[model samples]
Target: MADLGVKTPDVMTRVSEFMPEIITYIQTIIDNGFAYESNGSVYFAVSEFHEHPKHCYCKLVPSGMSNAELLAEGEGVLSGAADFVSEKRKPNDFALWKKSKEGEPSWNSPWGEGRPGWHIECSVMASDVFRRLGDPEGGMDIHSGGVDLKFPHHDNEMAQAEAESGSGQWVNYFGFKMSKSLKNFITIQGALEQNSARQIRLCFLLHKYNEPMDYGDSTMTHAITTESTFNTFFQNVKAVLRDAHQDDSAKWEGAETELGNAIDATKGRCHAALCDDFDTPAVMAELQKLIGSVNKYLETKAAKQEKPVVFVVKHAATYMTEIFKAFGLIGNGPEIGFPLGGAEGGAGKEETLTPVLDAVLEFRSAIREAARSKNFGDILSLCDKFRDDDLPELGVQLEDKAGSKGVWKLADPAELKRLKEQEAAEKARKAAEKAAAAAEKARKEAEAGIPPIDFMKALKLDDGNTPKYTAFGDDGIPTHGNVGEAPGEELNKNQKKKAAKEFAGQQKKYDKFVAKK
Candidate 1:
C-alpha cells in the first residue's frame, strides 16, 4: 500500500481485539428485535429488519435478498451444513455469532462460545472507531468493500449497525470491491512485480471505481503510454523553463491567453468530474486535452522562432503538478514532475544524480564544441555515443534538438536501454534492407549491361553435330553458330523448332535490355 502511495489509516482494528464490542453489538441487535438466538447461535433477523419502519434491509441492493446462491456464498462454507441451516429462523437470516465447530476458534459471547460472524465484526470495529473519534451515534459517511459483499455481508453490517444504534441509516454511501476465490485476483505485491505503482494507479484512474475492469496487458500498456506521454510533456516544459528569460514585463498574449483559458477550463472540469462520483477517468481526459493545448501553444511559438511566455507555461505546468500530487502520482517533495525512479525513492535518486549529470553534460558540451570547431568527426561521434549509450545506462535521457544544447532528464535505465536496443535493432534492420536493395539494383544493372549474345558466348555449348563457325545479328540471339548450322539444321525438325523458340525468347529479353538502355 505504501508502494502504491496509499496512506496508513489512523486506526487499524482487529476482530480479536474487538471481540467484546462485537458481543455488545450483537446483544444490542437482539434486544432491538432485529436478531434472534437459536441453538446457542445468534442470527440477524433479515425479514424483521426489512419490515421495520425506520430502516430498510439491503438498501444498497435490495435484489440481493433474492439471490440465494450469493447469500449462501456470503454466509460461507458452513452455511450449507444441516445444523447451521437449522439454527437460522429464516434462510435470509445471517449469523451474528456461529456455534463453535470442531477445530474452529471460539469466543465467549452472550449467546455461546463461538466466534463473531464475518459481517458483525466489521460493524463492531467501525462503530467502535467512530465512537472513539467522537461520533456518538457511531455511523459512517461511507463504507467500502467488494461488490460481492453488497448482498449478505455489507447489508448485514448496515442492518446490525443501524439496529444497534437505533439509527435510520448507518452510512451515506457504499463502494468498491475485489476478490480471490474464483482464481481471478492479483495481490498488490504480484501486480507491483509487473508494473510500477503509478502505472497501476493510472490504470484504475482510467476506469470508474464501481465499474468492472480487466487488469491485463492492454490496460497496462495504455497506462504505460499515458505515463510516458505525461513524462515527455513535463520534460518539454522543464526544458522550456530551463532556457526561459524571467521578464516581469512579459504580458499575456495570443497563445498565452489561449493556454491560460485552457488551464482554467481544465481545472473547473477536473473538479466537477471528481465531485461527480470521483470520476477520475473524466478528469484524466480533461488533463490530456489541457496538455494537448499546452503542446500546441509551445509548437506555435517554436514555429515562429519565438520563446514561450514563461509565466504562462509555468502556470499550466504548476497546475498539472498540483493535480498529479493530489492524485498521488507525484509525491510530497520538491520534485516538480513525475519522478523518474517511479513511486519508489525517485525524487531522492534524481536529486543525488543531478550534480553528476551536470558535470557529464558540461564535459560533453565542451567536447562537442571542439569537434565542431576542428571538424573532428570521431570526437563528435564519441560525444553522441556518450549521450545515446552511456547516459541512458545511468538512467538519463539526452534528446538532441536543432539550435539547442539538447535536453536531458532522468528515466528508468532499464527501460531506456530496452528502447535504445529496439531503436538500434530497427536501424540495423533498415540498413540491412537498404544494403540488400542496393545489391539487387547493382545486380540488375550488371545483368542489363551484358548482351544476350555475349552471355551465350560465355557459355560452352558443345554438341558434336552443331556448327563450329559463329556470326552476329542486330538482335542479341545468334543467327549463325560456330558449326555453321542454320538455327538447328544439324539436328532433326523437332530440334529446329525448339531452337527457334529458344531464339525468340532470347530476342524478347534483348529487346527489353535495349529499351532500358
Candidate 2:
C-alpha cells in the first residue's frame, strides 16, 4: 500500500489487539442463548438466531433458501476445504472459537485455551474501533469488503455483532463479489508495475462498484491515455495562467457572466454527482467538460490585453485544483516533468536525475534536428543505441509512441540488469551463429575455387569513406580489421580528420608497447 502511495489511514484497527474483546463477544452470545459450546469448541447458533422474533440470518445474502442450502454454498468458510465441523449441532452453525491444534498459537479464554474464529475476530475488532472512538452503541457507519463475504462471513459478523451489542444495521456494506478465478482481480503490485496510481484510481472510479468489473488491458489502457490527456490539459492551463496578467478593473463585457455561468453549472454538476453515491466518474466527466469549455473560452479571449478574462480563467484553475485535491490527485510535483521510472519506488532520489534527464533530452532534441536535415541515420541509430544499450545501464527506459514524441522513464534497476544480461546473451549467440555461417560459406567458396571476397564487402558493411585493413593467414583465410571508423558509420569531413588523429595516437602507443616488449 505504501508503494502505491496510499496514506496510513486514521482509525486503523488490528484484530490481535482485540483478542480479549473477542472472548467477551463470544461469552455474551453464548449467555444470550445465541451460541453454544460443544466438544470444547464454541459455535454460533444460526437456527436459534433465526427463530428469535427480533433476529434473522444473513441480511446481506437475502436469499429465501433454507439454512442447509446456504451452508452448502460455503458462505462463511475461508476456503472450499473448511467444511462443517463434526461438533457443530446445525450445518448453518459457525465456529466462534476453535480448540487450538498442536503447534498452533493459543490464547486462554473462558471456553478454554483456543483461538478466536475468523468471523468473530472482525466483529470484535469493529466493536473495538467504535468503542475506542466513542461510537460503540451504533458501530461504524460502513463495513466494506468483496461480495464473496455476503454469505457466511459478513452475515455471521452482523449476527454476532448485533446479538452482542443490540445494535441495528451496524454497517452498510458496499462492492460486489469479484472472482479471482474469473481473472477480474489484479494485485496493487501487479497493476503498479505498468501504471501510475492516478490511472488506477481513475480506472476504479470509471466503473460502477455494484457491478462486476474486469481489470484487464483495455480498461487500464484507457485509463493511461485519459490520465495523459488530463495531465496535458493541466499543463496547458498552468502555462496560460502563469503568463496572463491578473486585473479586476480591466473588464471584458459579458465575459464575467459567461464564465460565471459555466463555473456555477460545473460546481452544481460536481456536487450532484458526489451526492449520488459518490459517483467519481460522473464528477470527472463534469470536470472534463468544464476543462473543455475553459480551453475554448481561452482561445477567443486574449488574456494579456483582457486581464478580466485571465481573472476568470484563474477561477477555473482554482476550481479544478480544488476538485483535484478532493480526489487526492493534486500535487503532481513542482512542475510538469518527465515521468519517473519504477526503480525510484521507495527511494526519494528521482529529483537528482531531473536536470540530468533534461540535458539528455535537450541534446537529443538538437541531434534529431541535425539528423533530419543532414539525413544522418547514424544519429538516430546512436539514439536507439543509447536507449537500448547505454541508458538502460543507468536504469532509464526510452519509448517511442505513435503520434507523439518519445517519452523516457526510470526502469527498475533489477529489471534493467536482467534485461541487459538477456540482451548480451542473445547478442553473443547471434554473433557466434553469424561467424559459423560465414566460415562455412568461406569454406564452400574456397572448395569451388572461387576467390576469397573481402569480409566487410561480404557482410555489406564496407562504406566508401572508411578504409579497411586485412591480413591473410598461411591458409589464405582473412583476418579483418577496420581503421578510422566504427560500426554503422561512414565518417564525414570533420569526423575523418578526428578519426585519423585518434588512430595515429593509438598507433604510436602500440609501437612503443611492442618496442618495450
Give me the candidate number with maximum TM-score: 1
Clashes of 2: 4
**For model 2, what is the alpha-carbon lDDT of residue 481?**
34
> Candidate 2: misplaced stretches above 4 Å?
64-86, 209-211, 245-250, 302-308, 332-517
Model 2 scores a C-alpha lDDT of 0.67
Candidate 1 clashing pairs, residues 3+ apart or interchain: 146-177, 467-482, 467-483, 467-484, 468-482, 468-483, 469-481, 469-482, 469-483
lDDT of 2 by residue, 105-223 (tens): 78888778778887888888778777778886547765667766677678888889888887756676456645676566678888776666766777776776666767787787677
Off by over 4 Å in 1: 76-80, 178-184, 247-249, 340-385, 402-405, 412-517
RMSD of each: 14.8, 19.2
Q: Against the hidden true structure, what lDDT does model 1 obtain? A: 0.78
